[model samples]
Target: MPGPVPAPPAAGPREVLALAVPALGALVVEPLFLLTDTAIVGALGTESLAGLGVASAVLSTLVGLFVVLAYGTTASVARRLGAGELRRALAVGVDGCWLALGTGLVVAVVGALATPTVVAAFGVADGVAAEARTYLAVSMAGVPAMLLVLAATGVLRGLQDTRTPLVVAAVGFTWNAVLSLVLVHGPGPLPALGIAGSAWGTVVAQSTMALWLVVLVVRGARRHDAPLRPHGAGVLAAARGGVPLLLRTVTLRGALLATVAVAATTGAPSLAAHQVVFTCWTFGAFALDALAIAAQALTGRSLGAGDAEGTRATTRLMVRWGVGGGAVLGGLVAAASPVLPWLFSDSADVRAGITAGLLVVGATAPLAGYVFVLDGVLIGAGDGAYLARAGVLALLAYAPLLAVVPLAGLRGTVGLVLLWVAFAGGYMAARAVTLGLRARSDGWLVLGAG
Candidate 1:
């Protein structure tokens, strides 16, 4: 009898799990950190909640603006790894570190000057104004630490070293939790600073994580010349290479800030409640985002290894995994929504608002997860222009909805976010489909195998 046809190559569960393992804790801890911040501050009073929400919004907009370094660094590193140019990748990574630090310093100075104005623009009460300014000031102090960790971690992720970042994040969160309890509540010798203490605690936590990354990358370089270090020539070229990603992030930031503005304009209660729901939703997104990071690094490195087949297999498998993960988390969140609000706030209205919005977030989890994974694959392939266009399209779709927010109420604001997820997912899916077709035409991919 003739032998059976050979089975097609595909990524095993083990491989996918290995790639996605690093982001697992961050998926849990980051959202937990946000909740901790909200809970700790909310205990102080409603003004504290209002202040923290506005401050967090400003911080998100600021950080969101510079995500280019991350998107670019990952793809750049992945491309170099694919080309077997480890040294070049390290050089670009180092340059990115310096760029982020310098930019962060400028932001620190400017952010300090702009705090009052930004808080004012939010239109919060005089009673909450002091709390907002205090939160913003403390959070701004942590910018350098936060930027360092993000930039350095992005470079290492390109090299597929997710473990180190995970360790750093764990350490950061541990310090954050400990410091928050001691400082915010005035336990031991620490004076109780309330909401301000939570803000300061964040800075300290981020600093610890940033230092951890520095130590890891430095030690890695000392051992055998890590490609993530700076080099002479790629400095200028590397910065330029990050531009498209920067543009993509800038456009995306605009969308996010606009959303926050819409929510804020509705009233303080809407902002506070949004701050809570968005924080929970992010936990799910970031958890699944680890898969995207895995997919991006795998695709880039696989391509570098001259295994186009490997890249296609990895991307397809990752997308499926991401969607599945999202669905599971959404279900869990929906089921747990009954008890989640008690952890964040005691206000009946705020609790009800957060619970109501989470239902919508839960329903759309799978589609949103696809968007997150596709973004990772594209970023890994250095396709920021494509991402930028999609974001612009999504924003355009959202513009008209802005007028409808007041009428539809708080739930309407959350619904718009769901729509944003749909547009984003569609954009990424189109790109992935295009890439798959091209890979087939080039004879690097086999359809029947999948």
Candidate 2:
């Protein structure tokens, strides 16, 4: 046999940047909606701001859990595109959209009906709970639109296009901020709808974005002669494919939740500091994920083209990029840690706690980089089973480290630093070990466009 298909021509910086830059834009823009909502809703009153916080948390959880719609679809569609099965890729992506629609609708119904219960569960004051219920009720209207955006975005990413989603997200963000400002306060003839107006503004903005994406996908389907109607088997398969990734997500989320719980025991100052550091960490994660997203699409495409060596080479390149990117992020955070706390808090104790926590975060950034890239590569390989299993194992590894916090009576700044050490150091290292081992092996490199 001819020498195993020469590693698909070297995947250089150009290839990586093409996908990563737009991905970074889309990823970073996502959180701005919540930030805008907070700003607009804050001006209403304390009760309204509190309610928005609770409601926004619920919405974020819902959307985060369904991210598999994007990741799974990206892997599936990219593989087919790599296989030169353009029509089939489009058809698969359509099925994912259908599945997203069906799932979103059901979630919207259940979420809307349970708004009062969900709000009550948060245990807020009567006024806050009432506001939460109202905001969540209206916000439920946007859940389907949000899911549609996720799935459709995945479809485009799989098609090796990221710029479109970035554009749509930018426009949606602008519209949401403007409409929310006007509707929440009723700038002109429009009646002030209070917190509910903020919800509506977001809903309308999300729906418009969803519509735009659907139209684009529909146009692609038409050009490729792909089926738009939901096929029972195809839709079911998409759902099934997403399940493993869902499990993976759930476990990872569980780990984060556990970390939060541990942080809660360290006193109010520590908790406050932890929150700020965690938020910063999350922002950094979004930046790192941009490279991972590129790795996902490219890895899938390479494997679909049956170029295993190419996939391996490309993965190594991404790993390098991940390390470099992470080191830079870590350096920036370390440099800024002294001043960053002033922006978030004026309390000396809280600032001290944040500074301690951030130092640990800075030290571990390279490890996180290594872990995140392999994660994307595996996800691109559609190796969710291993990822799901590994996620649980990594969680298990971190649990004992976290347990030491309470046992050791770590408190205040000490507690926060210990927590970050366990999190960014212990937990991330566990993830790195599991993901690193998998990447070094050929087990996840299943070639062909199945």
Q: Quote the positional error of residue 108 for candidate 2 in Å.
A: 0.5
- Give each model's whole-structure lDDT: 0.69, 0.91
Over 1-450, each residue of candidate 1 has an lDDT whose tens digit, in order, gives 001121122456676677588767654665567678888888899998898888887887766677666667776665565566665566666777777777688888899999999899978899788899999988888898788877788788777667777777778887898888777889767689988899989999988888877666555554546555455456666567667667777766666567666677556655677777777776676777788887777666666556667677777787788789889988998898788888988887777767776776777677777777777777777666656665566566556655466556644335444433433344334444544444345332212111
Please provide the root mean square deviation of candidate 2 (C-alpha atoms, Å): 3.3
Error of 1 at 190 (Å): 5.0
Once superposed on the true structure, which residue ranges of model 2 sit more than 4 Å away at CA?
1-10
Give per-residue lDDT, candidate 2, residue 318.
97
TM-score of each: 0.78, 0.97
- Residue pairs clashing, model 2: none
RMSDs, each prediction?
Answer: 6.9, 3.3
Candidate 1: how many backbone clashes? 4
Candidate 2 per-residue lDDT, tens place, 52-145, comes to 9899889989888999999999999888878787788889999999999999999999999999889889899999998899999998889999
Per-residue error (Å), model 2, residue 126: 0.5
